[model samples]
Target: MIRFICCLILLSISTLVSAEEKLLHADFRHRPPEMIVENNRAAGPLKDVLDEAADVIGYKIEWRIAPFARSLKGLKNGKVDLVPRVIKTSQREKFIDFLGPIGHRQKDIVFLVRKGKEKTINDYHDLYKFEIGIKRDTAYFTKFDADQALHKILLLDDRNMSSMFAAHRFDVMVVLDKDSIESAFKQKDFTDYAYADYKHKQNIGIFYGLSKLSANTKVNAELSRILLDMSQSGRVAQIYQNYKLEAPLRLF
Candidate 1:
């Protein structure tokens, strides 16, 4: 009779623990094949990675959608718990605990222009000839970022940046990478854009960031350890492959 009572108590404790699994509020802007905010739920391979990691860590995610700037700001201010992709910068490092942790990847920063207009940008100085579209608060190449003379149109998110570029609202647009440009517009819209002949070389690093102020920030090491294992084991690549994509190649 005592043994039966102990088993029941154990089962009750297990049920309570299971019922109290933590929920994380992860936010993303709508960038397809990476993260797609659909039906107010996060659906994409990036989300899949977080899903797998969260499951292992005894947590669930409450996906949220906001503009890129808002999402970044939220990540700092505690409205957000996890952000799947964040460009790591010295300033950002102060407020964000980049986990998995702080992996760096190398990618080309491309300047895109309207189709048939590729040759217009043959040199660095030529870029000054037109208005440019760039994401707000995003770091591009060093000089391009620091230059004060460039006529840059600040955009909030990929879709808006894309729509403005597609509409010819700007003469030249610098993209985050190949995917941002490729997925910016429909396939039929391809004829409207082309990479400029001129190129500037720089590599960007991205990370899974946890707000320093979030209550869940305590799990930083556990989540980082889990994700680092996933990254090293080729599981990260597999997650991207499931969506017919390739994982961002890591530099370190």
Candidate 2:
């Protein structure tokens, strides 16, 4: 009887372990007000939304911090299942299946310059004369990328680029939006920088990229449904409000 009971207990434990949902892995950078990582945990409006969606979909997320390029490589190599904040591109579509516009609002790629230099960058053409700092391997806009005459200083990431811009190493730095500028300023404890709005504005949609090889279609479908429901039920908007961010345009 003792032997039979032990076998039964062992079988139950194995069944429980097998019944647990598969763990999903994702990568992120320290993009604040959208995605922020501190003490090895991710937070922010988008992160909160993702957490809620995962709960509803019955899965676990394992977030890893890595550079954007390395994260992209991980997705291609099937080592990472998802990237929480990615802008879709024709090239990226080959390996990544975008889930949804997880961000609450559209992001505008604008120029961040010292307060007194705003007038100098009135248009895209004016940017040609200044030394501009940009994040390496990031897309600002089609026009900005196609312009070969503009002088650009490519930096590794936002934090590094912001530090260089604060030190006045470059005349201007291109950032995602006003929130990005504010986040950078808060991180560096400097608020003298201002954003320049030009004619060429890129309204980028941020999404969660699921690796085509590793992501299960059925699980992704369920996650998509949960996200859509959250958006419709105003949960997504409430999450953004909690973080003091403007809610994304409703697309129900």
lDDT for model 2 comes to 0.77
Query: Relative to the unseen true structure, what is the Cα RMSD of model 1?
Result: 4.8
Please report the candidate that would top TM-score against the real structure.
Answer: 2
Best by lDDT: 1
Global lDDT for candidate 1? 0.80
Model 2: which residue pairs collide?
104-248
Give the C-alpha miss distance for residue 164 in model 2, angstroms.
1.7
lDDT of each: 0.80, 0.77
Tens digits of lDDT, candidate 2, 173-216: 88864665577678789887876756454465657888887855
TM-scores, in order shown? 0.82, 0.84
Question: What TM-score does model 2 achieve against the real structure?
Answer: 0.84
Residue-level lDDT for 19 in candidate 1: 84
What's the true lDDT of residue 144 in model 1?
A: 88
